[model samples]
Every structure is written in C-alpha cells, then in structure tokens.
Target: MRKSQIRNPKHRTENCPLSPRLNYFRIFLTFARNSIVRDMTFRANFLIDCLSTITWSLMDLGFYIFVVFRQTSQIGRDTGWGEWEFYTFLATTKLINGLVQAFFMPNCEEVSELVRSGNFDFALLKPIDTQFLVSLRKIDWPALSHIGVGGILLSISLWHITQREIDPAQLTLLTGVAYIFYILCGVAILYSLMISLAATSIWLGRNESLYDFWFYITNFSRYPMEIYSGDVGTPLRWICTFIIPVLIVVNVPARILAQPLAAETPEARFLLFFTPAAAVACLAISRWVFYRALRSYRSASS
Candidate 1:
C-alpha cells in the first residue's frame, strides 16, 4: 500500500461499513468531543475568554441603549424597529455570529498558517471531504458564550416587547420555526464567505488580512438593512445586498421575528424570499473557489 493510502486507512472500503451520512456525523461528533477536551485542558483560559466575550456583548448592548436609543425610537426613519424589537435583531446577530465563530472561525483562521507551514498537505490527504474537515476540525468553545448571551438577551427582549405590546409580528410556532431556519441560513452564508476567503491562502501564500477583511464586510450585517437608504447609503445597500448578500444575513431572520411581513414593502417582501436562495448560491460558489484554490497549492517539498 502507498504511504498516503496507509496514512488514511478510513478511505479503505473494508475499514468503513457505515453509510456516508452517518459516518460523517460520527466524525463530526468526534471532532466536537476532542475540541471540548482541549478547551477543558485550559480551563482558566477558557473561563477568561468566556467572561471577556460576555463583557463585550453587554457593553455593545449598553452602547445601543445609551447612545442610539436616546435619540430615536426606531433604528431608522419609520423602519418599525423599536427598542426591544431592535434588541431582538441584535440578539439574532449575536447568535449567528457566535455559532460561526465557535464552529468555523478557528479552523478557517488556521488555514493560512497550515499552508505556510505545509501542514495542510495532511488535511488534503484525509479520506473525508477537505472542506468539511478543515471547516469543523476545531471548535472554539469560549465563543459559545455569545450564544448564551444572545439567548438571554433574546428572551429579555421578547418579554419586553410582549409587555409593551410593541411586537408587530405575532409569535407563533410557525414564526419560531421560520426564525430558526433563517438563522441557519445566516450562519451558512457567513461560513461560506469565511471559508472562501480562507481558500485564497493557497494562492496568496499568506492571507494575514483575512480577519480584518471579514470584520469589515460583516460589520454591515450588524445593523438593520433599512438604515442603508438614500443616495450614498443606497449604493452600499445594493452592493452588500445583491453582490455580497451580507445585508440579508441577520436582517431576514430578525425581520421574521421582529416585524410583520404584511407591513413590509414589496422590495422587503421579495428579499425575505430571496435570502434562502442566496445562501445556497453562496455555498456553491465558495465550494468551487475552495477546490480551485486547492488545485493551485504547492507543498513545501515542491
């Protein structure tokens, strides 16, 4: 048997009897367990990281409350995103961002380093799909603090909205199902963008600007897309909406929970339907880009 084949015995037909879907799921659970063990090994550091994340989330919420809400009742001029409603949107942002960071950020950030050190060769030789392995091999457990914080914030926000009778949308089982679905869609869109950027490391040789670029692009998603109206902002709205689709990441999901569809304009209604399609397209494009970049890779030995 060849060296590469021997190193990846899982690829051998006799070594793998389970169905592919089940096999991949088992592999993912193993990766997640290993990650948890690694995090627990550094318990102090993990605790500090979690505390810091929670602190930052609180500070951000406070900023919006003291600064932004002091002046206007709604996020934009008549956008219908009042204080608690906007908080719901903010909470959704945290949930989506938290999930992406916890599951994929660490792995994607390591891609360039792996390429620089020639360790990515082993990843390429793995029996499973390279994208799946590389994207999920390491989970940042501390970042899950954001999800916890977001959940608390969401519950609080929804409670306030209900008490004040401010929610434009009725809360129902179907509404919740749609909200969770779009939240996953938002995560998928962001992951695709991150992995696509990471893939460029193979061609760029070093992609040190990955995080900076990612921050800049995603910063737009932190706010309601309705705020990007008028001449100057309209162009940015168009670019981020149709071209990059970051505008829809948090917006559509938040709108599903915070605002009524009947109150939305025709354009807004159209975008709500378009978001799922955009997520699918982004995943396809990112997959193509990753494989294309992989073909350009040259091992250190070469």
Candidate 2:
C-alpha cells in the first residue's frame, strides 16, 4: 500500500462494507457522544433540564404518596399490589420511560420538524437505514436522571419488600434478569409506538398534534392496567391491551418484580409470556409504517 493509503486508512474502512448491525451500533454511539458534547457545551441549560425532569418525577411520586395512597393501599381493588409493591411498579415505570425519553423521544419528536422543513430528504439519502438514523440521532441525557431516581426508589422498595417478607418469590438472580429483559421490552414497545406516530409526519407534512396524541395514549399506560376492569373499563382495557399493547408495556415487567409469580392469575401469566412477542410485533409494524410513509414523501424541489 502507498504511504497515502496507509495515512488515510479511515477512508478505506469507510468505503469497505462492514457488518450492518455493528455499523449501526457504531453510528448510534457516535450520535450519543455528539449529543453529550452538545449538551455539555451549554452546561447551565443541561443542569436546568436535568433538574426540571427530576422535579416533575418527584411531583408525580408525591401525588401518589399523599393523595392516591390515602384512598387505597394497592393500585386497584384486589390487584395484589401493596404500598411498597405499587412503589416498585412506579419505579419500573420511571426506568422504562426514562430510557425511552432519553434515547428515542427527542429524535422521534424531531421527525415532524424535519419533514416540515424537508430536511428528511437528507436523512433518506444517508447510507444507513433512514429509520435507524432518524430514530437514534439524538440523545436526551438530562432525561436519564429519571432512571437514576428510579433505581434508587426500586432499591428502597425491594429492600422493604424483603424486610417485610411480603413477596414469596423475592428478588433473585432469575427475577433480576427477567426484570431487566422485560424493561427492555417495555422500552421497545413504547419506542415503536412513538416512532409509528412520528412517522405520520411524512404524510401530514406537519404533525404538531403528535405530542398531544402521544400524551393521551401513554397516559393509559402510566397506571396499572388491572385498574381498567368492570363493564365500562373492560372494553377500554381490551382495546389498549390487545389493539395497542400499551397496557402491558409497564405492567408486565412491573408485575414481575412487584407481585409473586406463583400468585399471578392465568390471564396475567398469559400476558407475562405475551409481552416479548408484543414488543417484536410492535417493532415490525412500526418499521413498516415508517418505510411506507417514506414512500409517500415528496422532496422539496419536486
């Protein structure tokens, strides 16, 4: 090889075809590093954003503690969730939502703006998958504070459960592994929903209502799905659970850690096995939606 080729090895590697999965992972890491650097450049703003996220999370927790907890010990009547168990569930929600908000929300939210401005054309021209590039391009590091707070709350809740000997299954290695896996499943499901909603920007030209729609939909997932029982609520539960699958996003993993596995009803047991499959299906549907929307996109020049 010539001296010039040796000196510019990066050019060669860039041109060479590599494992698509590994290449995408590297691109994601690059995006993450760039986001961190960008955030750090505005240190004061970054700190304020982190503090704001933490405050909102604390306020949510306080509402449950003071008002909601005053009415009932568990989330719903006959739901088996005690005070600490409910806290465990809340913590799980925080962890899963935090991951989604940190890694995917910003990018997904920007899709509309990109589409409106016709900048999405540039993204489509990229060598990597447009969906992957657009979805993982931004990282909201401040939103990750929720995960830290969640970890702390989860530890405290688990410690109390162990001290009280409330849950017979307890937090074992298997449970821990299962908890983490399901958390990822929860994150995947939410990401799929958000990205699918965001992809509508391509057809709509501008989708300012995306956030509002997302908020209304995800509000259903925030609470325990079991609360959606009875004649009036049962139909809504079925729609959200089977049609949308948001109900299981947090409930499945949260139940694993918060409730005894042996005590789960047959229906709950079915959901436990169904959630991973739901996550996969959601992702596939989202991917299809994104590409289909892209097919309808019209360039600015055209």
Candidate 3:
C-alpha cells in the first residue's frame, strides 16, 4: 500500500500539471472569454453586427446565384460548377473568408495601428506573450457566427462532393484533415503576410493601398486557376500558389471536395500534392520576412 501510494502520487503529480503550451492556451481562452464578455456589454452593437453578417452572407449567395442563373440562361451550364459541388464550394469559401477577415485581419490591423501610434509599448509591458496577446486581443462577436454558417454550408456541400468524382468516406477524411491544415497554414501565412505589412507601417507611415493590394492578389483564388489561361497563367498560378498562397487555402481545398480533374492524371495528382506544400512554403517565407522586419522596427515616433 505504501509503495503503491508513492508511485501513484508521483504519476498523479506528473499528470496533474499542465504542459507549457496548454497553460498558454488556457490563458488565451481566459483572455478571449473576458474580451467577449466586455464586448457583450454593448449587446445592441453585437447583435446588430451579427445580423448584418448574416444578411451579408445571404446576399452574397443570392448575388452569385442570380449571376450564375443569368449566365446559364445566356451561355448554358450552371456557373461552370457542374452541380451542387460548386454551390457548397462558394458557401464554404465565403464562411472561411468571413472568419478570416472578421477575426484575423482586424487584430492584425489593430496591431499595426498600435505600433504606429507607439501604443505597442503598453502591449509589450503586459505579462503574457506579446504575440499571443496581440493576436487574441480582440474578438469580433459577429465573426463567431461565421463559424456556424460555414459549418452548415460545408455539411451541405458534403453531399454534392459525394456525387462528384469521389465518394463521401474518402473525401471527408482527406478534406477534413486538409481543412484543419488549411486554417492553420492560412493563419500562419496571413500572420506572416500581415506582420511584414505591419513592419512597413513603422516606415511607410501610410500604406492605404496595402490591404487592397493583398485582397486584389488573393481574389484569383476564389475560382479555378485554369481560368487564368496558359504561359502567363502558369506564372500567375505559381504566384498564387507559392508566393501569396491564399488561393490554395480556399480554391484548392474546395476543389478537393468539389471534384478532382482526374486524380488518375499526373497533372491533377501533382497539383494536389503541391497545394499544401506551396502553402507551407509561403508561410515559411513570411516568417523569415517578419523576423527581418522586426530587426528594422524603428519603434513609434522614431
């Protein structure tokens, strides 16, 4: 009994303590929940924003459907999408897009502003990790709704993906893992991209066009890269895949579920294999850029 107690206590003590990463996550969750409560205090604005988001999602779909219908009437074929496959692709992309904009971009923008204003000093003074704090400092309540909306749309899209070149079981597991990786890599690439931009704010003072430029570059990912045409399209597609890579996050993942060109084709399989690699590579470059930018950080007010 005594030996058992000693061994059990040792095991319990080891198991009871949280890992350093888990502790950090716990801290983040606590901070996020606190932020949410604070934001909730202004309930009117939160609900209004949430309602606006829902309206935006619905309207976006309505507009797409209307355009596709008109085009089909004139040129025939449903939006070049083939079947339900295209509809859910758009739906999932929309949801993911909203979540990224509402949550990730806002925080990054806020960081740039704070850095520009020299308020980043206050942030650095906080006890927690500066990156963690900056990343989760704010929560847009409306963006949470996008999570639910995207999930529902994705669920609906699953049926269509099934009817396509692949069946449910295979596509679901592959796409599921891919989606998780996409979000992580997407966020990493985004952070890498935005950190460099924020670093620029330290010098450029006003890059009003930066965000717009980023968006313009990313817009291509919403549709098939094939639409870009050849030769020149090849390089442009490379840029979208390896340089910016936002296109792969949405377009490639969606395509995976929507259908395969013919996995049997060498071109299709190569592109499929390359998609995640390209995203990871872009993120890695962004990280290096961010580190370089930090070295050049002039601090606010020079």
Candidate 4:
C-alpha cells in the first residue's frame, strides 16, 4: 500500500503558484513589456490609430466649444464650467479614456473569452495561477494617442484660462493623481463587469453582448459626466451611477479642476470611494459566480 501510494500521482501538488491576485499582477506587468514590443512591430497601425485619436479628441473639444458658444453666458449654471472650463474637463476625461481603452479593456476581453471557450481548462492546468495569465494576455499600445491628444488639448485649454505662462508641475499634480485613481477604478470596474459577463458564458455558451456592453460603459467615461448634471433626471442618473458607474472613474479628477484652484468642496475630495468599493464587490461576486457557472459548463454548444 505504501509503495502504491508513493507511485500514484493523484496526491501530487496542484500546479498553481501564489493565489490568483498576486499571480495576476505578476503576469500583468510582464505582459505590458511584451505588448510594447508587439505594438511597435506594427508601425502603420500605430500611426493610423494615432491620427484617429487626435481627430476624435479635436471633435470632442469642438462639440464642447460649440456648446460653450451657444450658452456662453449661462455656462456654469449648467456644467458649472465656462468655455475653458469645459475644455479642461474634456481634456482630462479624454486622457483617462485613452489609457483605459489602450491598456485595460482589451485584456479583459481575452480573459473572458478564454473562460467561454472551455479553454479555461488549459489555463487551469498551467503551472501558474490562471487568473494572472488570463488578465494580461493582450495589450494595445496605439491607444497611447489619447494621452498625447489629451496633453495638447489640456495645455491649450489651460493657456486659454491663464492667458500667461503656466507651470507644468501644477498640471502634473492633478493629472497624475487623477490618472492613477482613474486607471485603478477602471481596471477594477472593467474586470468585475467582464468577469460577471464571462461567468455567464459558461451557461449561455457565448458572451456576444460583451463588446456592446464594453462600448456602452466606455462611452460614459468618454465625456465629462458633469454634463449629466441637473436633476440628473432620477432614473437616468440612477442608471448612470449604479448600472454603469463611469462617473467616478472618469469625472472625479476633472471635478478637481472644475472647482476653483483651491476648492474646499467636500464632494471633490477622495470621491472615488464608492466606485472602488463597488468594483471590489462586483469582482468578488463574479469570482464566486465563475466557480458556480463552471460546474454547469457542458463544453461548447449551448
């Protein structure tokens, strides 16, 4: 019996390394480095997407500027922002959106699909934690155009506001803080949302709606959420806030700039609390759902 037990592989250690969380971060960083190289190999794609990025940014600025001119006098009453103010708001939002699209969302799609194809079994069999590999598989560097367009627009907007020399350090402080928290919440919300959807792939046999869902969610963040102001309707605001939750991810930093240079507003301070908390809960719930859904998966055809 002892010899048989020694020969048997059934009791061997499972292949997984550290828990999912740590492994996810590790693979994510390595994947980032590789993606930069991959994207460079396709220079034409990068140039084309870069032009699109700048064009889209210009269009966004044009839309807001047109609105500003239409209501030049009654501006702040609506967005609490004037022409320059609105430009500033959009510049930041654009930058954040660019980063999210370029880096985060693409990878989320890869993971969720892996689960749906019954390919998840191969991932589970790897010697590394599955979640880590799943999250960091694909990256798009062309999205970096949003960052450049954002900088140019922001500088132009700031120049309009100051009408004098502006300091880079001051600009950096706000953009830096906003970008950090914005990406964190973005990653959190996207992963949670994708996981939730992907979990259903096990039962539904396809998450075809995922692309649509991602497009809708990102659209909110593309514009300044403050425009959704006023009574915020009630039902509309409820949908925007609870269902999509893009406001916290995209608008908070712009909120910082929307107020006066030295704002004392309580709502503007550390305002991402709700979004991050929700992301955590959503991701957790999705993880649990994954295991439950996996049990029901019958491989391929629904």
Number of the top lDDT candidate: 1
Q: Which ten residues in a row have the lowest lDDT in candidate 2?
A: 1-10
Scanning candidate 4 in windows of ten residues, the lowest lDDT window is 1-10
Local accuracy of candidate 3 as per-residue lDDT tens digits, 97-188: 76666556666677667766778767654544455566666667677777667777777767655655644324647667766665555555
**lDDT of all the models against the reference?**
0.89, 0.85, 0.62, 0.63
- Give model 3's TM-score versus the native structure: 0.79
Provide the lDDT at 134 for model 4: 53
- Taking the tens digit of each residue's C-alpha lDDT, what string does model 4 give over 38-85? 878888887887888788777866766676567675353555566666
Clashes of 3: 0
Candidate 1 — worst ten consecutive residues by lDDT sum?
1-10
What lDDT would candidate 2 get against the real structure?
A: 0.85
Residues 55-119 of candidate 2 have per-residue lDDT tens digits of 99899899989998898887766777778888898999899889999999999999999998888
Best by TM-score: 1
lDDT at residue 186 of model 4 (Cα atoms): 58
Candidate 4 lDDT score at position 15 = 59
Candidate 3 weakest lDDT stretch, 10 residues: 1-10
Residues 1-302 of candidate 1: C-alpha lDDT, one tens digit per residue: 34446334456645677977788899999999999999999999999999999999999999999998999888777787888889999999999999999999999999999999999988877777788889999999999999999999999987776667434356889878988999999999999999999999999999999999999999999999888988999999999998999999999988878875532779878886889999999999999899888878888754
> TM-score ranking from best to worst?
1, 2, 3, 4
Q: Which ranges of candidate 2 are over 4 A from the true structure?
A: 1-17, 165-169
- Which regions of candidate 4 deviate over 4 angstroms? 1-26, 66-78, 111-117, 159-179, 222-232, 260-263, 266-272, 289-295, 298-302
Clashing pairs in 3: none
